[model samples]
Target chain A: MAENRLDIRYVAHLARLALTPDEETKLSAQLGNILGYIEKLKQPDVAGVEPTAHAVPLINVTRPDAVGVSLSQEEALRNAPASASGLFIVPKIVE
Target chain B: MLHRLTISDLAAKLARREVSAREIMQSCLDQIARVDGRIHAFISHDAEDALAQADAADRELTRGVAGKPLLGIPIALKDVLAVKNQPLHCGSKILDGFISPYDATVVEKLRAAGAIVFGRLNMDEFAMGSSTENSAFGPTRNPWDIERIPGGSSGGSAAAVAADECIASLGSDTGGSIRQPAALCGVVGLKPTYGRVSRYGLVAFASSLDQIGPLAKTVSDAATLLGAMSGHDPRDSTSVPQPVPDYGAALTGIKGIKIGLPAEYMIGGLDPEAKAAVDTAVKKLAGLGAEIVDISLPHTDYAVATYYIIATAEASANLARFDGVRYGARVEGADLAEMYCGTRGAGFGPEVKRRIILGTYVLSSGYYDAYYLRAQKVRTLIRNDFLQAFETVDAIVTPTAPTAAFRIGEKSADPLQMYLSDIFTISCNLAGICGISIPCGFTSAPRLPIGLQLLGKPFGEESILKIAAAFEQDTAWHGQKPPL
Candidate 1:
C-alpha cells in the first residue's frame, strides 16, 4: 500500500458526506489501489509545461450589462425541498 | 419498422407526405413498450407529450411550411440535461423529487429544430462509472446480450439507439462516457471538439471536460443531430463563437486523408478479437484510399491517472450545490452541517461517494501541489502529444474500448479495473478534440459488437464526420441490429 494512505473519514467530512463504517473501509482500499497506480505519474518529466485548465484558450468573457427576462420567483422555488415567502428553508446554523 | 429508420430517412418521408410524424412516434412508442422491459434503456418517458409534439409537427407539414431538419424526429435525452417540466435526477437519489423549470440550451435547440425530446435515459450516477450499474434506477442491459452491460455512463443513450427505442438520443462525455458506450453498443457516437456545443444547462460533472454529443443508428443521423444541437450560446462562455458546419454535407469521402494509428494503444491488455476488428477496419480505410500512418503518443499511459485527478477535482466542487437547502431531496438534521452531510450520505450512491472522497483528498491542503498540480502538468504533455501528431495526420484511429462488453458485475467489484475500460477513449477528452465511434465488426462466439474509433483535431468535426461517413458507407456493420 502507498505510505500516504488517505484518511477516509476526514476526507468524507471535508466533502460533506456521511459514510457508513463499511463504506469507509471499502472506499479506502479502492482509492489506495487507484492512488498507487497514479504514482506512475512521477515517471514523466513535465518540467515547465504549462498546465492547461481549459483545452481551448479562453479569455475572461463578459457581456454588456442589460436587464433581461429572468425566471420568476415561483419558478425558482418550484423545486425546493422546503421554501416559504420566496426564500429557501434550511436547518438552523447560528442560533 | 418506422422507429428503426434513420433521422435522414424519416425526415425525407415526412417531407414527401409518405408518413405522418405521429405514425413515426407511435412506432417508437410501440417498440419501447415491446422491448424496453428487457433492455431497461429509459428511466421515464412522456408518451402523451411526445404524441402532442408529433401532432404539432404534422400540422406544420400539412400547411406546407418548410420544416426544420430535425422536424418530427423522436429524440431522447440523458437525465443529466435539464428539460422543462421534466424530472432531472442525474441517475442519483440526491436529486430525488426535483423537476427542472427550464430547458437546457441543447434542449431548447432540439425543440427549435422540431425534435420531440421525450424520454430520460439511464446513466452512471453523476456520470461516474464505466457501466450503467451505478444508476439509482437500475442498470441498462446490453442490447446484444441481456447479461452484459451497456457501456456507460451513456449506456442507456447508446442502448436506446441500438434497440430502436427512440430515433436517437443525446449524451454527455467527460472522459469516455459517450464514445465508450457507443462502441460497446454497436452504434454511432460522436464527441464534438470542446466548446463545439454549448454546455449551458448541463449538470456540471467536470466543467472543463464535459461536452454534449449525439448517439444514433448511423453516422449521418449523428451528423444531423449534431448540427441541430450545436452552435454558440452566449449563455455559455466556453461555447466558442465558431460557425456551425453542415456536417451532413461533410460526408464526401476520405480519398486522401491521413489517419494516424498510435502504437501505444495496441497495449497488452487489448482483446484479440477487438484488435483484429480494428486491423480489418484499417485495411478498409486504406482500400478507400485513406493513408494510415503509424504514430506514437508517448504519454498515453498517464491519461487515466491525469483524468481521475482533474475530473474528480472538478466534480467535487460542482457537486457541492446539492446541499439540502435550495432544490432536490433533503434529509434534515439538527444543524446545517449535519443536514448537508446527512442528505448527501443518503442521496449519493457508493460510486459517487467514493469519487467525492478521492476528489476531496486530492485537492485538500498540502496535497494539491502533489496530485492535482502534477496531473494538470501531465495533462499538458498528453494534449501536446495529440497536437503534435495532428500536425502530420488529419485524425487518429484506435479501438474505442479495450474489449467488447463484459457481463454485468464483472468489473464493478474493482473500480481500478473498471477505469481501465476507458483507456483508449479518455485521451480525446483530455486533448479537447473531436472523436467518433462506428461499428467496425462483431465478435463471433457470443456475437457482440466491436467499434472502431476515429479522432479529429480541435474544431475538426468536419474531418472526422467525413472519414466516419466514408468508412460507414463501405461497411454493412452498422446495418446489423442486435438479436433482441
Candidate 2:
C-alpha cells in the first residue's frame, strides 16, 4: 500500500457513509490494492497536458433559466420516505 | 414466436395486419412467464399495463396509424431507466420505494412509436459491476447456462433479449456492460457513440461515460431501436446536437473498409478458443474485402486502472444526491448526519460501497493529484491513441471480453480482478467512440458464446453498424438460441 493511502474510515466519513468494523478492514485491504495498482499513472510525465473532463468535449452548455412544466409537489413528494406538508423531513439538527 | 421476431419484422407484420399488437404483447408476457422464473431477468413488469398499451396500439393500427417503426413491439429497459408510475428499483435497496414520475426520453419515444414499454430488468446496482452479482436483488443467471453469470450491469437486458422475453431491450454501457453480456448471451448489442443518445432520466453512474444503447437478436433491430431512441434532448446537457441518421440504411457491403486489429486485445487472459473465434471473425472481415491491418493501441494495459479512477470519482459525486432527506428509501437516525449515513450504508450493496470509498479517497485532500488528476491526464493519452489510430483505419476490431462468461462466484471476491476484465470495453467510453458486439462463435467445451467487437470513431455508428450487419447476415451464430 502507498504510505499516504487513505484510511478506509476517513474515506467513508468524507463520503458520509458508515461501515461496520469488518467492512472497514476488508475495504481497507481492497482499496489499498486498487491504489497500489494506480501508481502506474506516475510513469507518464503529463506536465503540460490538459485534463479531459468530458470524453467528447462540450463547451459552455447553458440554457435560459425559464420556468417550464415541472414535477408537481405532490408527484415529487410521493417517492419521499419521510415527508409532511409537501416537504421532505429529516432528523433534527441544532437541538 | 412474436417475441422471437425482430422489431423490423414485427413492425412489418403489424403493417400487414397479419398479427394484432395484443398478440405480440401476449407472446412476450407468455415467454416471461415461462422462462423468467429461472433466468430472473426482470425485476418487475406489469402484464395488464403492457396489454393495455397493446390494445390501444391495435386501435391505432385499425384507425390507419400504421408503418411507424417499432409499432406494437415490446421492449425491456434496464432497471436504471425511469418509466413513469413504475417502480424504479435500480436493483438496489436505496431506491426501493421510489416510482418515476415521468418517462425517460427513450421511454417517451418508445411510447410515441407505439411500442409496449414495461419490464424493469435487473442490473448491477447503479450499473457498477461486470457481473450482475453486485445487484442487491440477486444475480441474473445466464440463459446460456444456468450456472454462469450474465455479464453485467446490463445482464438482465442481455438475458431478457436472449430468452425472447421482449422483442428488444435497451441497456446502458459504461465499460462493456452491454456488449460483454450481449456476447456471452449470444445476442447483438450496440453501444452508440457517446452523446448519440440522450441520457435524460437515466440514473447517473459516471455521467461522462454512460451511454444508452440496444441489445437484440439482430443488428437491424438494434439499429431500429437506436434510430428511434437517439437525438438531442434539452433535458441532458451533454447530449450532442447532431441529427441521428437512418442507421438501417447504413447496412451495405464492406468491400473496401480498413479494419485495425489491436494486437494487445488478443493476449493476456483471453481464452485460446475465444481468441481463435475473433481471429476467424477478422478473416471473415478480410474475405469480405475489408483490409485488416495490425495496429497497436499501446496504452491498452492502462485503461482499466484509468477507468476505475475517473469513473469512480465521478460516481462518488453523482451519488451524493441520494441522501436520506429527499426521495428514496431511508433509515431512521437521531440526527440529520446519522440519517444520511444510515440510509446509504444499508441501502447500497458492497460493490457500490467499495466504489464510493475508492472514489472518495482519490478525490480527497493529499491524494487528489496523485490519483484523480493523474488518471484524467492518462485518460487523455488513451483517447489520443484511438484518435490517432482512426486516421489509419476506419474501425478497430477486438474480442468483446477476455473470455466467455465465468461461473457466478469466479471473480466476485477480488475487486481488482473484476475491474481488470473491463479492459477492452472501457477505452471506447474514455475515447467517446461507438462500439458493438455481435455473436462471433462459442467455446467448445462450455458451449458459451464469444463476442467480436468492432469500434468506430466519434459519431461513426454507421460504419460499425454496417460491418456488424454484414457479419451477422453471413453467420449462423446470431441465429442460435440457448436451450431454455
Candidate 3:
C-alpha cells in the first residue's frame, strides 16, 4: 500500500489537480481505505490458473482498407470554443 | 398516442403507416415538455431537428420504401455520446459549450434506421459515479420517487424511458451505469458483450470497460435497440466484427436452459428485500421449466478491487486528452501550464478529478506492477472464473444492485460505497460478457424496483435475452411502471 502522504501529493501533481489541505487529508484517508480493501486480493488462491486479459477467445479483427468521409473544416470548427483561420486556435505556448 | 407504446409497438405502427415518424417525434417532444421539468432527464433537446428527421422518415414511408424496424421511433442519447452538431457537455461545466462534429457510430446507425435523435440526456460528469449527483447539471430524480436518484451515470437515459420522455435511450455501461439506473427506475437495460457495439464517438471514461447499450421499458425493446446499434465500425479498433444476431429471434423460450446462481453473490452484504426479490425471480425461472444450479465464482469478492484499479488506471490515461487544448472549456492563465491546470481543475467535478488522480498513481512508474499490473492479473482470474462457470451453465443470474437506489446524497461522500453500488454488475464488464437487468420485484422499503441481472457467456446475448424474455412473459415485473 502507498502509505506516504507525499505520494498523494505527487500523484495529484501528475493529475494536475490543486488539492486543498482538507481535500488532501480526506483523499488520503479515502485512498487508504480503498487500498486496504484491495489488499484482500492477496489472500485468494490461484495455483495454476493463468491470468486471462480479455474475455473473448477471438482476436485480430481488422477491416479492409477503405476511404471514408472526413469532416469538413467548417463543420469541424463549428463547435470550437475558439477558432481562427478555419483551425482550432489555442493560447500561445511560449513566452 | 405513442407515449405508452414500446419500441416494437411503435415500429409496428410505423410499418402500417398508422402513425408517421413525425407524429411519434412530436408525441415524445410533447411528453418531454410536459414532464421533463420534474424528471430533468434531458440536458439538451433538439425538437426541430428531431421533427425534421421524422419528416424525412415520413417521406421515406410515403415513397413506399420498406421502413426500418426503428423507423420514426424517438430515442434519447446519453450526453456522453457525440451527436453531430449538438452540444455534448457530458454533464460537465468544462465542456459546457462543446458540440460534436460527427455522430457516434451508434447514433449514426439509429439515424440510418429512421430513429429520431430527440435529445442528449444527463449523466455523471463523464460517467464516473453511480449516482447522477456527479452531474454538473443537477442530478436526475427517480421517476418512481422524486426524492431518490435514478441510478446513475446513465441515470438520465433510464429516467427518460421510465418517465416516457422517450421510448428508448442509448446509455453507456462502464461499471453498471446502464443496469443500475435501469434497476432503480424499473426499466430494462442491456450491456452488450464488450466491443460488441462500437465506442467510436463516445468520450472516453474507461475505454476498455465502457460500452454503449440501450435502456428501454421491455426486453424486446432493448433487443431491438441493441440489434440496431451494434456492428463492427472501422473507427473503433476494439469493436468486434462478428455477425450481428437477430436479437428478436432470441426471445422465444427458456425451456431446459441451465441458469447458474453464483453462491458468492448470495452471501451477506446484500439487502434482504433485494435478495428475496432475486430469490423469487430464480424460483420463477425454475418454475418456467429452466434448470437452476448453484455455481461458485470464487474470485467474485475481488472484482470490485480489481475493477477500480484497472478502470481508474485506464481512465487516467484516456482522460489525459482533456488538457484544455482541443475542444471544450478552457480556463485561461498566464502560461500554457497554468491554463491546463486551471482548465482541468475548474472543468472536472470532484469525483472525476479524484479517480483521475488515483488512476494516474496506480499507473505511475514504480507503482505500476503493484497496482495496475496486479489488477490486470486478477482481472484475468476474474475472467477465467466466469469462463469456468460458463462451462456448466448457459447463463448466470444475480441481483443488479446490492440494494435499491438510495437517496440523492446517500453515498456521495464515500466513493467506495458509491463504487459498491455497481458490485454485482461490474464483474460482467470485467469478464467481457453480455448482461441484462430487468425489473424483477419490488422492495419493501420504498417499494422501488429490484433488478434481476442475467449474465451470459461472451457473445451469448441471445441466451441471456431468451431467459429474460421468459421471465418477462411469466411475470408482470417488466410491465409495472413507476408512478411519477
Candidate 4:
C-alpha cells in the first residue's frame, strides 16, 4: 500500500483522475483502508492452486458463416459530439 | 383495461381482437403519465412512435396475420439497452444527451416480434449499484413502500412492472440486478444461461456476467418474454445457436420433480422471517408433488470477493471507452489527458469510479497475481461447487436476497455493505447457470416482498420456470400488488 501523498498522486494519475487537494487527502485514507482490507487475502495458503480465470469450460464460440452489414457511417456518427466528413472529430494530435 | 392485465392475458385479448394494439399502447401511455412522476420508472418515452407501431400490429392482425408471440405487448427496456432515436443516457449525466442511432439486437428482435417498445427505463448509473440511488437522474422509489429502495441496477424495470406502467420489462443481470429488484418489487425476474441470450448492445458492465432478461408479474409471462427475446444473434458472439424452446410448454406440470435446497444459503445472515417464508414455499412445492432435498454449495462464502475482482477488472477496461471522445457528455480541457480526466471524473457516479479504480489496482502489474489471479481461482472453485451440487439435484433453491429491501440511503455510505447485498445472486452468474426470482411471501417486519430463487444448470430455464410456475400456482404471492 502507498503511504506518501506523492505516491497516492502517482496512483491517481495512473487511474487518470486529477484529484483536488482535499480529494487527495481523503482518497489516500480511503485507498489505504481498502488496501489494508485486501491484505487479508494474502494470508490464505494454496501450495499448488493454479490460477483460474474462466469459470466454465469454454473455447472460442463462433457464429455461422454469414454476411451482415454493420451500422452505416452516418448512423455511427449520429451520436458524436463533433464529427467531420465521415469521421469523429477530436482535438488535433499533431503540433 | 390493459393496466391490470398480465402479458399472457393481454396477448389473449390481442389474439381475439377484443382490443387493438393501439388501445393497449394508449392504456400504457396513460398509466405512465399518471404514475411515472412518483415512481421514476422511465427515463424516455416516445408515445407517437409506440402508437405508430401499435397501429402497424393492429393492421397486420386485421389481415389475418398472427405477427409474433410478443405482438402488440407494450414493454419497457432498461436505459442500458440501445433504442434507435432515443437518448440512451444509461442513468448518467455524462451520457445525458447521447442518442442511439441503431437498436440493440434485442430491441430489434422485440420490434420484429411486433411488440410496442414503449420507452427506456431508469437504472443505476452504468448498472453499478444495488439501489437506483446511484442513478444520476435520481433514485427510483420502491412502489411498495416509497421510503424503501427498489433493489437495483434494474430497479426501474422492476418498479415499472410492479406499478403496471408496462406489462413486462427487459433488464440486464450482472449479479442479481434483475432478480433482486424483481424480488423486492413482487415480480418474476429471470437471468438466462450466460450464452443463452445476446449481450451485443447491453453497454458492457461485466462482459462475462452481463445478460439481458425479463421481469413480469407471472412466471409464464417471464417465460414468454424470454422465449421471444432469445435465439442465435450473429451480432452477439456469445449467443448460442441452439433453437429457442417453447417456454410456455414447459410450465405445464412439475409432478415428481426434484428441487434442491442449498443448506449453506439457509444458514446465518438469512432473516428469520425470510427463512419461514422459504420454509412455507418448500411445503407448498412438496404438496405440488415435487421432492425437496438438502444440498451443499461449499464455496458460497467467497462469492462476493471473487465476483468483485473479476467484475471490477472487466468494468475498468469496458469503461475506458467513455473518455471525452466519441459520444455523450464531455468535459473539455486544454490538454488531451486533462480532457479525459475531467470528463470521466464528472460523468461517472462515485460507486462506478470506486469500482474502476479498484479494478485497475487489481489488474496492475504488481498486484495482478495476488488479487486478480487468486480471485479467478476462487471463482473457479465457486463454479465447481455449483457443478458438483447439480450432480445430486436438478435445480437449487434459496432466498434471492438476505433480507427485503432496505430504506433508501441506508447503506449508501458503506460501499462494502452494499456489495454484500449481491452475495446470494452473484454466484449464479459466476457458475454460468440460469436462475429466476419470484415472489414467495412477505416479510412480517415491514411486510416487504421476499423472493425465492431457483438455480438450474446450463439451458435449464425450462425446468426452473416449471418449478416457479408451480410455486406461483400454489400461492397468491404473484397476485398481490403494491398499492402505489
Q: Best candidate per lDDT, number?
A: 1
Expressed as tens digits, the lDDT of each residue in A5-95 for candidate 2 is 5778778989999899999999888888887887777787678888888875578888889988899999888888889988887777776
Model 2 CA lDDT for position A24: 93
Tell me what fraction of the real C-alpha contacts between chains A and B each candidate also makes: 0.84, 0.74, 0.53, 0.36
Q: Pick the candidate with the highest TM-score.
A: 1
Cα deviation at B280, candidate 4, in Å, is 1.2
Model 4: lDDT of residue B216: 94
Flag clash pairs in model 1. Answer: none
Per-candidate clashes, comma-separated: 0, 0, 1, 0
Count clashing pairs, candidate 4. 0
Best-performing candidate as measured by DockQ:
1
Tens digits of lDDT, candidate 1, A1-95: 12557999889989999999999889999999989988988899978888888896679988779988789999999989999989998877676
From the highest DockQ down, the ranking of the candidates is 1, 2, 3, 4
lDDT of 3 by residue, B1-484 (tens): 5876898888888778888888888888888888889989998798888889889888988887774778778888999998877888888998877878888999899988778887989999989988899999899999888789999989999999999888999999988999999999999999999989999999998877889999999999888888999988888888887899999998998889999999999978899999999999999999998999999998889999989988898898888778777777878877776777788878888888888888988888777767777777788888888999999999999999998879989888899989988889999999899899999989876789889999998889999999999999889987887775
Superposition TM-score, candidate 3 onto the true structure:
0.96
Ranked by TM-score from best down, the candidates are 1, 2, 3, 4
lDDT per residue for candidate 1 within B1-484, as digits (tens), equals 9999999899999999999999999999999999999999999999999999999989988988774888899999999999999899999999988898889999999999989999999999999898999999999999999999999999999999999999999999999899999999999999999999999889999988999999999999999989998998889999998899899999997988999999999989999999999999999999999999999999999999999999999999999999978888899899989999999999999988888888888899988988888899999999999999999999999999999999999999999999999999999999999999999999988999999999999989999999899999999999999988
Q: Model 3, which residues run further than 4 Å from truth? A: A1-6, A45-67, A86-95
Runs of candidate 4 with Cα error greater than 4 angstroms are A1-8, A22-52, A55-58, A62-67
